[model samples]
Target: MASRPRPPPPAEEQVGQSLSLGEFQNVQSLSLSAARMILHAMINHRQKGSKDGSIAMPETETLNKTLDYLELFARFKDQETTQSVENILGNYDELDTFEKSQLASLCCVEVDEAKTLIPSLANKISDADLKDLLDQIIAKRQFMDS
Candidate 1:
């Protein structure tokens, strides 16, 4: 008898009320600010570990490009502000981890805008609650900038 062929993988990843992250299903999602902090800390640790106290360039061109992109887009520059944003998002237990991260990274100002960007958020949170959350995030951002 012939052996059966294996099934093909999912055609695309989806993130709505249900997440279909494919290979990344178990992976923890991170906000851009958090990713930036982690990458910077890792570079600092490498620098500290080296004899010259200076880190080498990122191992790959992709990593170098990623670092540059994060530098340009990461919203929260300081740890305190990042933590505040995380805390605000964390309070909304209904949100998925991906949703929380997207909220922090995108920094959407309006409920409709957030819902349009992260469709899963539409059914999970009411407009008033989302507006309140956005306001809090905006306030933190303003404080950081000032």
Candidate 2:
């Protein structure tokens, strides 16, 4: 009998311990705030460019739901705060893009909570450093609120 060819690796989208994002592995990941900003900008641009002063592109139910969810859950609202959070996360060379986005979006108050929520973060950063990062994020959020 002829020898069989080796099978390809599975393309599961795993984010725990280590990332197995499959097709998205090399793609840039955005935080909830960033995603919200981009979507809002696109919507606004489309609306502004319409000849009839109406939405150039029809809004789908999925788009409306996504916008609503982002409005409710996105931690940083304004562009300045969003940029600050991005900058803070970007400074951490230890974290991958996905990890940084997860950290920014979740905005966990404690190191343990962050690690518990983002298991991959457990071995990536020290508890004290993670706590400091969390503090910075919280402080930015507080400043935005006030």
Candidate 3:
């Protein structure tokens, strides 16, 4: 009888400690912070618009770009980072100055914040990458309850 073939290792099991170019390239697509910021911005922005003439939904382009980035990140989750979003961001080279500035403005959060995000988030997200933010907020809630 022929021997059984082995299955490939999971993404979390991939070799090496640092990010390769392939890894970095894979991550640019999605960002939790970016999505959350966009969502929040849309909500806040809509609230400011006058109710008079016409009501427009959040800008389609904003949603599209944010979703594109997030979906990309989500897709890569299984193929990389052991499906850990924190690992993905942690190992990457980070966003550029313009991107960073845009992110900072959108999130009112710094890149350092990504460093502390929990790995439980992995690929799931909506408008902003709030996995970390949400986790942190929850942690605070526990502290407050105590």
Where is model 2 poorest over a 10-residue stretch in terms of lDDT? Answer: 46-55
Better of 1 and 3 by lDDT: 1
Give the per-residue lDDT of model 1 (tens digit) for 1-146.
49888889765788766667777776778999999999888877776667576556545788789999999999998888998899999899888788889999999998989988888887888999999999999999999999
RMSD of every candidate to native, in Å, equals: 3.2, 4.2, 15.2
Error of 3 at 115 (Å): 13
Cand. 1 Cα-lDDT = 0.87
Of 1 and 3, the candidate ahead on TM-score is 1
Q: Pick the candidate with the highest TM-score.
A: 2
- Kindly list the per-residue Cα lDDT of model 3 for residues 19-135, writing each as its tens digit: 233334354433454445455566666767746446756567867786667554422222222224333334324333223222222332332444333222222332255445434
Model 1 regions more than 4 Å off = 1-7, 16-18, 52-59
Superior by TM-score: candidate 2 or candidate 3: 2
lDDT of 2 by residue, 10-114 (tens): 789987987778988988999999999999998888888797776488889999999999999999999999999999999999888999999999999999899
| Candidates sorted on lDDT, descending | 2, 1, 3
